[model samples]
Target: MRKFNVFIVLFTLFSLFISEKAKGFEQAGIYSAKIETNQQQQRIYGTVTDQNGETLPFVTVLVKGTNIGTTTDENGIYEINVPGNVTLIFSYMGFKDYEISTDGKTKLDVVLLESTVRLGEVVVTGYNTVERKHLASSIESVDMERVVSRPIIKLQEAFAGTVPGVTMLQGSTLPGDVPASISIRGISTLQNAEPLVIIDGMEQPLTDVDPNQVKSINILKDAAAASMYGSRGANGVIIIETHRGTTGQFKVNVNSWFALQNPLNLPKFVNSADFMRLRNEAYSIQGQPLLYTDADIQSAQEGKTPNTDWVKEIIERPATSYNTTASISGGGGVGTFNLMLGYIEENGLNKIEGSDKFSARFNTNINIADRFILLADFYAHRLKVDRLRRNNDGHGLYQIAWRMNPTQGIYYENTDIPNHYMLHNDMNPVAFINEGGTWNYMYDK
Candidate 1:
């Protein structure tokens, strides 16, 4: 019985040794090798460790520029089949990649250093700023410098196509009547899906802020958003940081630009002569009486009658728009402060439509005794929009012009009367905009 027990003990010990050796062979890519293939391929074996000589398990050992690779075992032991004149790369998660050449020798051990890239960059999150690598998968940040340089009249228009997982709603051209709105990636919620917006740590509408003054915009989605503001950030969170003074002498900057606004495309209607001919042809095909006489058609074709272009009469070409912004920023022992003044004037396609806006922003940080700091912000803006009447929203204004008959001119032959009447089916679109029957809207906030 004693001899049999000793035999069992020896058998178990030998079985463990074979299992460990097989695992090492599998990790080295030698388990799949054939006896004849071993004669042509060279086997390179190595151990990957950290700078402190700690073994790094599961490290990848790959032949450079080839899809051949293998992973190290738990003991950091890796063996790969190579062509002798090949380079090998060693990589591990969160560590710098280590590379070496197999210049005829077999053994090639390397130590990998930890990567510093994740430790350097920072990201703004819900409660505080975190390192970029920690939350990069759930957060998106905008490149403000690139976006601010665009020629945008409304600050809301600046975010047209900058970030991913965010959608900006279509804006209006009715001067100050348009406000910017954006929706983040759709969240599974019964409530509204609009993302929560916080500008300078304060709840405010996005349209009220100027694009030039923004320094950074951080969007938090998924778990990163829900853990911050609870249900308020259920859909998503957009945090906006405005430009503040830096530690430097007083610096002044002025930016100005102008753009020619024109309608993208407008419907072209047939002239009066073509309209009469087409109408007569249609009625004749339908076996109905023609509306115009032969003399009228003859006179129209001979250029004796005028072709009224109602669109040109009401719409202005190359509507001029200009924007200017000036800002002063500085800092001292007391604290930092930034003051900016901006103005924008825009002419719409319609003759009676135009807008001018003035805005000023001042933000400061004052250091108190030793343990306190005061942050104060002031923003004011005034807007004036012409012909944006309370009753007429301008949504159907252009449609009326397009549907108007081309037979009537802008004014009557008798110009002695003030507000000379232009009639088209007793409804003239040009008169609604040009006849002093419109209202202007002025807003200050």
Candidate 2:
């Protein structure tokens, strides 16, 4: 392999016609410069490399608008004589051409950027895999590295901008607002438009799986690809493969991240002063009794009196959340074993609304006999989520919070209940979250 590579490099360098032999001249900046050239011509030579500094053999170097050119050697070095100042053009297959002015100097190393088209690359498709040149179906691979680089709590959140044909709608920032649906081909039918998600050959909800455990994800979007799954593939198909044990020495991996959660856009509401003044003016115009007296209005406007903000009270801002996952994997001549443990704490927009999850997974492959291996895997997780209560009529806590009167206090000064202040209204958001009610959901799977 090394000899083959050396041969290719040498062939590429020799393919280009190098300049006159070096004689009694210093090197070009860093490389040996060819000298003893014509009085009217100058020596220009440099190495051509790719973005990563790998020497690119077979690169074409030419003086713009002329046939005078040379190909880069196996070492990517090209020595040429230029007649006065001119633009030097560097061209290579599979890379963008680079141009630079001689600018009256030597040592002009060039770097070329690789073209976006990646040919001959292998890709996974529906029920099969093929190279890019042979692939007839539309498939997208998710960048799991970029996805898990951050502290993402949900699977859909990691995929928002990672792949094409996936759409994420504006949903609540609350911890319980888990993604349940996705659209790839748009609304083609009236039934479930959610794409079919297959994890390790088992059909399941993508949102239920954790991003840390996922190894690779492939999406099948074209009609030809969807045909394999029948109607279920009409929406789309997502194939996921989880991380497994590796052979050789034992390895331990741990990942932990912290993130501050905040709403992208919070609703803007009128202040208590403006709200009170507007209400009083309306009452006066209707010939009804004024809600606030001159002194009361002055005090409220001057910020002397308390002006409650239900929205702020209902939603926690800049909530902090974190997650940690640890795994151990190894393999021997007889078997391989992998075990993982994870914990996550996710805070929601509303105080007292959050989620805690604990998960464990163990997988092993035992070679009971040659050519006959047994695979056993076990996974368990416990999840507990807390959120504000909702009524049968769908009047959720946030809706009630938005409609609360600005003047209505969260709680009365005195209350009949011992050691507890009574709420000014049955719909008080703070009271509901503090005492009225809340919903706690626990799941073990």
Candidate 3:
């Protein structure tokens, strides 16, 4: 590989030598004296020596613009004949490039330091690159490897495990949905809990982005970095950069996962006997008539005869989730192209129903020339949801299940009331489920 690289470099340099001899010199300068001074051109004499006081070998001395150049002799000395005002460049592969004005001086003695590209400082501000020491603001960077390390379903999920001031609050009331609360530097508003999300140079809502498509996520914290973005950045700005291939190689990567989730914080509801006791206490305080007979009262005093576990009945054991993603990317001299497809299946604790999603994405970057670049991207997702129940908030499920009398069975078996509508105002979980009062089918794209 080293030999191949050397060959390519030498071949290109030789081609430049044979194609033309540099000759763009013109009489374009200030006065007649300056023109007269360039009659025979001038000579810049320089000696190259290593740091240990030993003469260095084979240093190339060239004029800045024109490709007219020569190498030092074995003694590490060279004299280049050029215009007195021209710029002389001293360069060695491992040493820093030195440019000097060939005016008002003779015997130029140049000291060069070892060039360290990898250890040298690099700064990334937005999409621009500058020296690390030049930045005055506090900007954080997340590399590609670190972004993909987590088992994240949404692009925002990667931030959950990484950022310090950022907090993620998963919604307990709604399970299969994405995280509802994401705050940076604490919650700034009761109306809006999420920060601003930006992809490339365009702005987007974080909830609309998928993790599989992202290459990195950068969180710009503090006022110094956030102020430039104006009002939209009061919450903070999450910048996302997607992956693209180089000009010659094809890159393919696949990511997939299967997850099982039980409820993180499941609420415990009182059993039928305790519930009835509380209910009787409330009725007594309100001066209402006794709703239960002596036999029902006897059953309620015992811990268990037929107590309903309302929370358990509504929430199933665990839900299963699976996500798959595949992408193909390649490029040549003309341009680069990328295509990706993703599918997700999520099931909630409600055993009868779940949510499914499928998405497709397209991205392409073209090098218009050596100095210009063009990028284009578009993506869309289709979602379908099958839910056995709609949350009428905490009121529907809890109000019904907690108040159902322990004496009554799920069906009206051997009840003296005889009519299903007898307790129309009373909370009944079985009736809510049977009467099709809690079901939903949603399609969003």
Best by lDDT: 1
Q: Kindly report which residue stretches of model 2 are placed more than 4 angstroms away from their true locations once superposed.
A: 1-120, 283-290, 302-305, 333-335, 349-351, 365-376, 390-395, 414-425
| Superposition-based RMSD of candidate 3 using all C-alpha atoms, in angstroms | 14.5
Whichever of 1 and 3 has more TM-score, that candidate is 1
Clashing pairs in 3: none
Q: Please provide, for model 2 over 1-445, each residue's C-alpha lDDT reduced to its tens digit, 9 standing for 90 to 100.
A: 2433443354334323221111111124113212443346678988999888899887877665543566788999999887678788787768887889998788798989998766436566646667777777788888888888877887877767678777766454566456435677565573577788887666877655778988888888878555788887888888887777753335667677778866567678777778888888999999999887878778878877667788788765667777777676755435666777677777766567777877777788886643677878777888888866652122477787788777666655556755354455456667776675777888888
Q: Quote each prediction's TM-score.
A: 0.68, 0.66, 0.62
Alpha-carbon deviation at 262 in model 3, angstroms? 1.1
Candidate 1 segments exceeding 4 Å error: 1-120, 186-193, 388-391
Residues 1-445 of candidate 1 have per-residue lDDT tens digits of 2433443455456445644653464445443443435546788897888989999998867665533677899999998777546778777768987778898888888889999867336777756788886664578888777777777776567667888887778756666666456778754454776788888777777767767778888888776787878888888888888888753235666676778867777777898888898889999999999988888878877877767777677675567777766676755434667877777777776666777777788899886762477999998988888873422565666666777777667777757887787776766766767664667778899
Tens-place lDDT per residue, model 3, 246-347, is 433455656777787775565566766666667778888899976555566677667435666655665655877767776767554346677676777766
lDDT over C-alpha atoms for residue 117 of model 3: 56
Pairs that collide in candidate 2 are 9-74, 13-73, 13-74, 16-71, 27-33
Ranking by lDDT: 1, 2, 3
